[model samples]
Target: MTSPADLIINWDVARSTASRLVPPGPSLSPAAAAREVADVRQAAAEAVGYVHTITGLSAAEGLGEDQRDVLVVDRPGWSAANTESFRKLLRPALDAVAEKKPQLVSEGSSAQVFGSAAAGAELGGILAFLSANVLGQFDPFHSSEHAPGGRLMLVAPNIVEIAKQLNVDRSDFRLWVCLHEQTHRVQFAAAPWLRDHLMSSISTLSSSTLGRADGLPQRIVEAVKSLRQEMGQQKVSDQHDAAAGVPARNRLLEVLQTPEDREIMSHLTAVMSLLEGHANVVMDAVDDSIVPTVKTIRRRFEQRGKNRSPLEKIVRKLLQLDVKAAQYRDGQKFVGHIVETIGMERFNTIWDSPEHLPSEEELHNPDTWIERMGYTPKG
Candidate 1:
């Protein structure tokens, strides 16, 4: 059996490459850095307190605790942290690939070495793109060695850069960002089962996909054919439209082939949509008295998404970040619709178990989930 660490050779190269690709933000003086860190820490704590009360979910019940430390890091630090997290998350799948290596390659062959290099390079490029864009992430897989359990990470530089670009008040914007991330912290903390559920889904999907390597070539061919057919149907003017031109059935979907994989992916999508949408809801629902600039911040943030440069737009499509925007919008709408129809208490029941989660279709049609859950709106 191959070790997970052996799957990606020269990960340092990936880290360095990503760091290089990320543009540097204006440097903070020593005092400024210290102050920023202090502000984020305070804001994060307050945000958590607000979320706990607003969601009506006790932190002790959800995560078995009330608070987690928040770590503020620059782009390079954030990228490095995420790279380690991804390694942990992807290890099981990588191990599955290693188990199949003998059948895929002969002893003393250099193919494994070459493949690792390519994989590492691709992983690096993807991380590089993400490091430049992600504002904050509450990593469930964060290493305890880094801190007690895993602390919430706020990418200080990215937050500062975005706030400056939007011309928003830094203090309010900082707290706003913290609120969203802190909500994620509260989510996994409060719903103790969520971390395990997400890990299981990811592990199963990865192992299933990697274990089917023998059929990968055919799957790729089919995916290419599907893409071509999709392209052929689109008008010339629509050819470059990222959202419409690219069909949802891509290489990963084609490779996973089995009904089991599809089901797993659907579950994963639904859960993520809930998590993301819930965060957005919590962030927006903050009292205007607390986050006075919330409306302006949200409006400009939406405009920022619509006003990306041509190159940035292409990069977003390639990095699958475009799907992220859809997730936010679609998920927000879904959660909002359900909550409006059945109330937050009924909507919160979806988090009770995996079965209660919405399907892809149910995400758009709240009635399906409402009916299936047998929930009736208050008279």
Candidate 2:
């Protein structure tokens, strides 16, 4: 076991071998960068050091190996221009969910939620391309926090470009994704079973220390380039043979989820779907009040189809979890129906306790959503 003192923060572990995730802010001359640093200091003092600063989005290679804990990055390149579009896609959902759980924004008497749970400082950063190195896979992240356990990692999602790909305007979509990551932080803080379930599942698959390796095999690189070439000419089909890609990883996930893990994963996925779904519902409800200029910016990626990463395609091929376009539709429909059946206020009240959320059985049936609430909705 690598001791805390010996755990080396290797730059190779960063998403790209060439660099580290940079902090926000434009490229600066030494003098200009100095002034920006001062501003960062001022912001840090106001918060509990929850947020960190970065120079570029790619400086992940530069992180201190010894550094650990939840880091909320206050980026330098932040722009209303960049974020505004997503607000449109996400406003309806955010507004509705907010209406559902008003106290979440308030109710300070209870504990606060962590911004994210990550294996490293980088888990939540915005990624033009996602990778296990950056967003630590749930199947592998684990530890014994009980004994100086670094088992739990808190991370925040910095998904600036996600809505652009989805082909939806940003307003609501960005906020909702943020909320989903935020949901993890919330789940970790509020649901003890959640942390256990996630960590246990991760540990069962691999170990506490699945650090990044040096590089991919040369053959795999050649293979991937070859595949991309062939793919341009051929429509993907079952016979298209993705297994030909190099560095092929085992998709079955060796560690099977225990009944406890399954229960937790199902609920967590459902809660995430609900959280995101509710955000969409909220957006649709109060969309009349949504700002105008924000609507002008179209970040449209919603209907573009499933995230088409090689890893995603591989998983779908292996597990047949097609992740329908309507996957989220059910959640949206479920929440909307609930709000229509019971008044929004009553619909919102269920979030007061975890028990009020639906079970897997309910998640399966859009029509049975209200029935799962153990009562028919009041027309």
Candidate 3:
């Protein structure tokens, strides 16, 4: 008997609950904290200049001249910031849903109160798991209309903990992290339309979800059943060769009942893969003299991904981190293939406009993208 309004999540409560559940770890000594902050700031600047040089984009081009600010925060701070961002992003869709059905909440009904509390708890649990593992994030909405650029957020405690766990040289690892994140900044700066394009796509998806909310529960159940069947088939295929498991598909996208939902998700996945892949390539392309431990760091990082604990792996799967990791690998390979075949100058067309962006299928087969882009591979 719960109304749809009752399901509108109380994200503020969720943010607070998540922060409490995943509180920051042991505090760094004052000197260590200060040193870390300084190093990150320096790295951020260096990375921006380095990426600009490598990408060959200047301010006169679409690249914005504004500088990106860096903020170092603990886990709790990060959780709070991201919760607010999610709230902003989701509010329009929620409001649209309400407009379509005015009677979702009856006057004097307590269902809304109870539903909000329950939704908050669910969201809190998910965020609690994610906050621990996220090292850094680039938030496009961090700035106001007057300020057109974004900010780079470094989760100080998590970064420090990860470095300690991996036993990597502290400076090298921190710089490496900054390099990847900064590449993202350069991407947005170079392609000012990208932020709007992503936001538009996400809004479209959210609106679609809202329009289909009435059947959402049933759709989700059906999707789960379909997924289980697919997994069974995958297991049978795996039995032939344990090392060659089924290829990783975007399982989340596969679960959507509507073709529209699946299409939006595919576009989003392709865009994300391109961005992450481009960042990975740039980070690795840094001269060895710049990062003496670059090879060791890369090896250890890949090992960390492969050796996650069962609990951690479940959490990752829930948050779609597994999908993100797959995107990184797939994207990196796609970028490498295209660059090697057509050369970087031709490959750079992908950034020229939305039309130049590859489709999800094209991401798996660079040759298709190459042909589509009217580029012939070198002999």
Against the true structure, what is each candidate's TM-score? 0.88, 0.41, 0.87
Candidate order by decreasing TM-score? 1, 3, 2
Return the lDDT, model 1, position 95.
70
The parts of candidate 2 lying over 4 Å away from their true place are 1-128, 131-256, 286-288, 293-299, 303-327, 366-369, 372-374
- Angstrom error of the Cα, residue 283, model 1: value is 1.8
lDDT of 3 by residue, 1-379 (tens): 6334335777768887898899566578999888887777676666666676666656323232334356777788888888777776776676677678654444345766666677787888777777888788888766665445667788777778888889999888888888888788777776778888888888888978876888878877887787666667765453232233333334534576378877888899899999999899888788767778988888898898888899888777667676788889899999989988988778887888999999999999989999998899887
* Whole-model lDDT values for every prediction: 0.75, 0.37, 0.76
Q: On a 0 to 100 scale, what is the lDDT of residue 67 in model 2?
A: 29
Error of 3 at 328 (Å): 0.3
List all candidate RMSDs to the true structure.
3.4, 17.3, 4.0
Q: What is candidate 1's lDDT per residue for 1-379, written digit by digit as tens?
A: 7454554444666677777776776689989888887887777767766777667766523332334456788888888887778778888777777667654333335775676667767777777777767888889876575444466888887887899999999889988998889878877766667777788899999888888878888877876777667556755343453544434544345443678998888777777888898889888788678888988998999899898899889988787777776678778999888878988778777777778878888987879999999988777
Higher-TM-score candidate of 1 and 2: 1
lDDT of 1 at 181: 90
Q: lDDT by residue for model 2 over 1-379, one digit each (tens)?
A: 4212111221113233212443332344777545434433232222111111111112222222222322333232221111222232233433343344444333222321221112112322333123211211111122334312222121222333343445454444433333223233333333345444444434432221122112325445655666566656656554433544311221112122235545555665576566556544543433223323224322233333344778757745554344333445666777777767765555654554667776656765644656656666675
